[model samples]
Target: MSELTTLARPYAVAVYKRAKETGTADKWSDALAFVTLLMQDEQLAKAAANPKANREQFSEAFLGLCKDHLDTEAQNFVRLLIRNRRLDLVKYIAELFNQYKAEDEGYIEVDVSTAFPLKDAEQARLSSVLERVLEKKARLRVDVDPTLIGGVYIKAGDRVIDASIRGQVERLAKRLWT
Candidate 1:
């Protein structure tokens, strides 16, 4: 995981820079998503790895698959990836690029896991509190986990606040044993 992330960092940075300069972060996001999906297709992987495949052949096949979705700049980006044999890195590159873009835009992707489904009012209140605490716009993705017993666990980037009853019980048991 770390190695893939290391290999992907430079590509992500370069793409982010270009996107920032051209005001096309959203476009790049869509392009990267398309490429990432293409990379996931088994047939495409076989084609990409074929010993007989040349850059032109690969690019033609790839572009043909994406012709309807990508613009010229996106096509050039795909060509560059093919030329550099970096098509395999598309997923990691897209993930890292989105991370960078989110940071640049002062937005945080947060995961909130609750014991049960959240009502609209509850979700709105949580969002309000999170926005205030994080001091930025919060893009919250919520999930339900009955095993949590009660309360919620919130993860924002590298920070995690585990307020679930299950978590508290585990911590208390550990303290008692120690």
Candidate 2:
């Protein structure tokens, strides 16, 4: 795992526990989504990175941007992050939080890359196969990559099964060279 992932795990777990206790998982999900978006904005990210911007300024700007979307609990969470200087972990935190949410909901996040979009039936088949392979229900995100040539690359959590033509060719070339 990356350092960011390591740093993010505890925060994600804490938020998940709070959401579970309060029966507000969806609300926290929305708030975290907003925080993730705010962190992605270039200007806001730069401002957050600026040492001259005090914690109060960062918290105010962040909460201001998210005012309509946030509840008191969410606002306090943002303030806590700012005070702890963990704003840079926002993205990673969201990622980990979503992972926990999915697990709690009995869903696995899968990434699939193929040369073209799969039909509805094809997608269903892929999801079925992945569910069977992973022993969990899957929610897949499909991406079309022409450079893949053919076949699909499936990633479920830390496991990657690359069945793409490019991957196969590269392996073949490596084997031949060796």
Winning candidate number (TM-score): 2
lDDT of 2 by residue, 139-164 (tens): 99999999999999988888999999
Error of 1 at 115 (Å): 5.2
Against the reference, the lDDT scores of all candidates come to 0.90, 0.90
**Model 1, which residues run further than 4 Å from truth?**
46-53, 113-115, 143-153, 163-178
> Which 10-residue window in model 2 sums to the lowest lDDT?
44-53
TM-scores for all candidates: the values are 0.77, 0.91
Query: Candidate 2: lDDT of 20?
Result: 95
Worst 10 residues of 1 by lDDT: 44-53
Query: Per-residue CA lDDT of candidate 1, range 93-150, in tens?
Result: 9989988998999998889999999999999899999999989888889999999999
Instruction: Report how far off residue 73 is in candidate 1 (Å).
Output: 1.4
